[model samples]
Target chain A: MDDTTARHTEKMRRIKAARDEMMKTKTEEKGLIIVNTGKGKGKSSAGFGMIMRCIAHQMPCAVVQFIKGARATGEATFLRERFVDECRLFVTGEGFTWETQDRDRDIAAAQNGWEIAKAQILDPDIQFVLLDEINIALRNDYLDIDEVVDFLLTQKPHMTHVCLTGRNAKPELIEAADLVTEMTLLKHPFRDGVKAQKGVEF
Target chain B: MDDTTARHTEKMRRIKAARDEMMKTKTEEKGLIIVNTGKGKGKSSAGFGMIMRCIAHQMPCAVVQFIKGARATGEATFLRERFVDECRLFVTGEGFTWETQDRDRDIAAAQNGWEIAKAQILDPDIQFVLLDEINIALRNDYLDIDEVVDFLLTQKPHMTHVCLTGRNAKPELIEAADLVTEMTLLKHPFRDGVKAQKGVEF
Candidate 1:
């Protein structure tokens, strides 16, 4: 081979070798759980980004949105309409508690959402299961944190990842999570008395 | 009823109506794909129960097993594996192509695995990208489909998922798929292959 050809071949070989090492490292990586809490917007959005990242890798995922009822935001609506069977999406509960102050009813709604979430979370097939707004529900007493934690711990080890989002995350939930993120509320449109805009908050 | 009880009752009634109207319809559900193609025995076994059925209730689905990776002894494995990700795993492609000669390597081996796969199929965030029994590197020319497909497409689309399993799935892949399955065929331990194992071959 000519000198130029030889030089190019060496460079290509080195690049391929480096890439091979990187691919091996990535394949060996394990799944994880992320908790996005604190008073702020985009906590769920951040979690959604992670979800997108996994999907890019063809990882099957499930999202169980707790305590978010009939108010169809942009994310829930798109997921519900587009995510298909590969990534399971469940939106349960009766909106926020303030909107529906019936403790008994809220608890029932929470239980219903939890029932679906329990099955998804325990399933080893799911790479990641997003329990959107779960942290807030636990703090508000809509769902029992003790039971939820117990269920999470008992799931089949490995092959299943979990993500929890929402505000007022209890200390216990944060402690149990693998990766905890606090989305501190700096400022939001709601502060200016403006309602949620389409495609942004939803 | 007391004033508070009456108010709570009315609130629940409203919530119920909203939930009823917001319930997702069957046609509105998203679709998923699960492939059980590989040279190993457990490709289907691992995939069937893991992801297919977990999202069954959340949405409708279909399964296409590209090839019968295993013989006839793994029926139970297939049956049990048909949990969360079942409906999506369809067995098509004609049992392990390596045993046949039609298998040709149209693509180059050195090229990244993700590059070729990205050239055609676009949705990497697909709920499940199950490419069963796809390892033909040793048997045929290395086309590197796995690397290409997994790299460009195997992304976690806003809750989408993907899973791949096989004996020879290349380590240096183009796609850093979210979930990957590697089915190992241990000692057959059978005496000269006495009539193949039942429920295990399919």
Candidate 2:
């Protein structure tokens, strides 16, 4: 063999050995409680991507929007219209906090949303549940973190994966999550006076 | 008006005024250079989500994978099988750095992938272009950053939205980007001895 080919083969051998060692310890299979939080875009978008992944796997899923209101997002319209059997969508908020300044009304919306989320979590056929913007509701104290955590711990099916997406995720929720990602804002067009566009932001 | 009704109306009036002011400043429409990079997961997954968004809008799109090998990823499989007319998939890498173990081969792969990506960027029919893991290739010196940036600036269609996803994005790229998100790793299941699952990871 040539020198370059021999060196490459040797390098791959070392990598394979290390990978095998890492793979040996990764044998557990269970549902994941994933949290996507921080001050950046794409948290809910990522959650929606996971729902699409579930659909690709032919697994049923549901989405509950907590603070985005009844306005038709591109995701909501597409998922509801195209994948009816695979997705059950509920847009449960009047709007954002500033848009709906009444705390009592926001609280009632959160409570109503939680009930639907709870039902989806208990449904055996639904393998994936996306609680879109639930973190913001939790951050605003619209929903009790303890109640949410308790239900997530005790009632979720063993193989049912749940993802919560929004900024300011509660520490208690983070502590209970199996995976957490914080989308850090490096730059945003809105800061430079660009508006959110259809299909891109919605 | 009753006390509660009067308060609610006032709150909505304030909200409407703020929204109107914000809307007045957001009138420009152009293509976006979006970057997703960091040490956390979901960079490429989020890019795939954008492809889905484009599909939902009935806009044509293309994805060129730079570091991920020509394996049958769930996103690739589903997109190719279902959205044949809307998506153009190109898997141009043999594998990751360790898997390939040859810098020259890696560079060649990146170059070839960039050619495909360039064509897609200039295609007016394709509204969205996803350069999945191209940032890692650039970080590894598999491709020239200046050439990529210049091409992105000069040749991209007026309305084509391009997304680049990977870790260690170049500073120059971030500066040129319209939107940038850094996915921070808070907790990963791999660190906790959980294996990557089919639907979630692939």
Candidate 3:
């Protein structure tokens, strides 16, 4: 082999050993509070993917999309049509806060959505609950962060996994999260005058 | 309404108008080269999510996982059992390049895997392709980036959407991509002694 390749092979050997050693010590499994936030895209998509992962194992899952996103997103349609046996979806809010045009109106809409989310989250039958875009509600103070976190951490079943997706997640929520991934937008097509397409942006 | 609420609503109204105007100018639809990369957790999940989005529209899809991650992950099993009519999965590689312990062996496996991927990507029947963890192969020189990009951009059909997921994506690949998201790992359960769960990690 070439010189660089031989060196890389040697380096990979060390990394492989380290990873193997680290992996052996981990044997504990618990429900996770996974948060996907930041200004980048893919948060909701990743959350939906996690739901898909659960449905793969025949595990019961639910999705509660807070704020907007109720106008027939691609994921919502797909889930309703294909995985009805394993999944339930709730796309909440009349519109975004801006569209609602009033603070009280926005909160009232979100509170209504939260009632359904609370019931599904606390339901013992559900194993994975994707709190889709609920972060936006929390960020805008439409939902109380402490109350939401308390239910997720102390009230929810030990085996229940929750993934919260949206931008501008609260700092307290991040601190309490077991997994937090920020989807950073490196480049977007809209800047180049391209529009969101079906089966892609939806 | 309160003074603060009135001010915020006014600002939102203006912003909403701008958005409505910008959205109308976009009517183009083309195949996209989407790249998800970074030291984050949701890269693959988001890619899988996009695949799910397509499935929502009943678009044909295929997933080709590179490097490792072929030990019966949840998504792989789920897609195979449930979406046989909509999707196909091809998992390649004996192990990671490190596990292979030989550079040539790694390349051979990657090349073998690429053949399957190229076939699926070029296939007119498929609308979306997820090249799961392929950035690893390109980063390690297991496959040539230029050739891959050329095929994805030129040879592949216009309606075909491809998502390349992994860390350390090449500059050329990123430059050619339509959407690029970096999954920044802010918090991981492994750091706090928690193990990867079945549905969450897989």
Candidate 4:
């Protein structure tokens, strides 16, 4: 080997050793409370992608969409058509809060979706559950924050991984979560008057 | 209808009218440059999810992994097994930079990956291209950011969407991108002594 290659090999050896040492301390494993939130795109998309990974692993998944109304997305269609046995999907929202304009109706829809979500979360048979846009309900006071957090922290199944996605995730939820990622918007073409594309956006 | 229902209906009608007016101004359709960056999880996961979206839309996709090495991921396995006809994945990364530890080898691998990426990006038949972990390559100076940005802006087809995902994305790429999202880490279980789970973390 050349001088550069020899130097690199030696450097890599040191890093690998250090990494291995740190990795040894990580031994705990349990179901995770994951949240995807913020004022950016791909929060829901990322959640759906993990569902695909779960499918690859032959894990059962249930998806509960709380705030987006009766709109079909590409991933939803694919999941419905191909992975019926693996995925259970529920779309339970009247519409966006601005479009719906009825607080009681919004609360009713959120509660209904939460009931289904809770069932899925408590089920040991299902390995993954995605609560898409349930945060909007919590943020709007349509769903009780304490009840949700209590169930997630204390009552949920031991092996059932759950993902909550939406903007404005509550501080309590973030604190309870094992993983929380906020998708921050840097720039969006919609601000430039570009229409949302079918596969890319919806 | 009751008084509350009537009022809610009227409010929704007015909001719908306003939304219809704004949506009329958005008529442009073109390929998008999307960037997912920052110090959080799911940037790569979101990109992979869009690839599933593309598959559902019956669009062709190409994915070039820039820094993940030969590691076998669940999504990559699913894509290869199920959507082989619709998706083409090239795992070109030698490994992570620190793991590789050779600047010249890193540059060579990145250049090789870019050549493959450029072919996939320039191809009109491929509707979506995902350059996974490419921002790492760009940030490390393994590839020319200007040349990459110029190609994406000027040479890409009109209807092909490209997603570049990793941390520390350059300013030029973000400015040139149609959509940019930074995955900010609110909390991570790994830091709290949880090992990376197989299907979830991989």
Candidate closest to the true structure, highest DockQ: 3
Question: lDDT tens digits, residues A99-151, model 1?
Answer: 67576777777788889887887777777788888876788677888887777
User: Alpha-carbon error at B154 in model 1, in Å?
Assistant: 41
Candidate 2 chain B, run of 10 with poorest lDDT: B69-78
Ranking by DockQ: 3, 4, 2, 1
lDDT of 4 by residue, B1-202 (tens): 7897788778878888898888888889889999999998889989988987888888889999999875777787888788889999898998886776777889999999999999999887899999999999999899999999999988999898999999999999998999999999989988889888755777
Model 2 quality (TM-score):
0.93
Q: What is the DockQ of each candidate?
A: 0.03, 0.54, 0.66, 0.63
Q: Which ten residues in a row have the lowest lDDT in candidate 3 chain A?
A: A93-102
Q: Global CA lDDT of candidate 1, please? A: 0.50
Query: Tens-digit lDDT track for model 1 on B1-202?
Result: 6786678778767876775454422122222222222332434434433332223223322233334533432332332353334333333344343332233321222123323233223444234344444444322334445434544454434333344444555544412332232322222212122222122223
Error of 3 at A71 (Å): 1.3
Q: Model 3: which docking level applies?
A: medium
Question: On a 0 to 1 DockQ scale, where is model 3?
Answer: 0.66
In candidate 3, residue A83 scores what lDDT?
Answer: 81
2 or 3, greater by DockQ: 3
Model 1 residue B196 lDDT score: 25
Q: How does residue A166 of candidate 2 score in lDDT? A: 93
Worst 10 residues of 1 chain B by lDDT: B191-200
Local distance difference test, candidate 4: 0.89
Tens-place lDDT per residue, model 2, B24-112, is 89877778899999987678778887777777778788999998875667787777777788789998987887776776788899999
Tell me the lDDT of candidate 3.
Answer: 0.87
Top candidate by lDDT = 4
Superposition TM-score, candidate 3 onto the true structure: 0.93
Report the C-alpha displacement of residue A160, candidate 4, in angstroms: 1.7
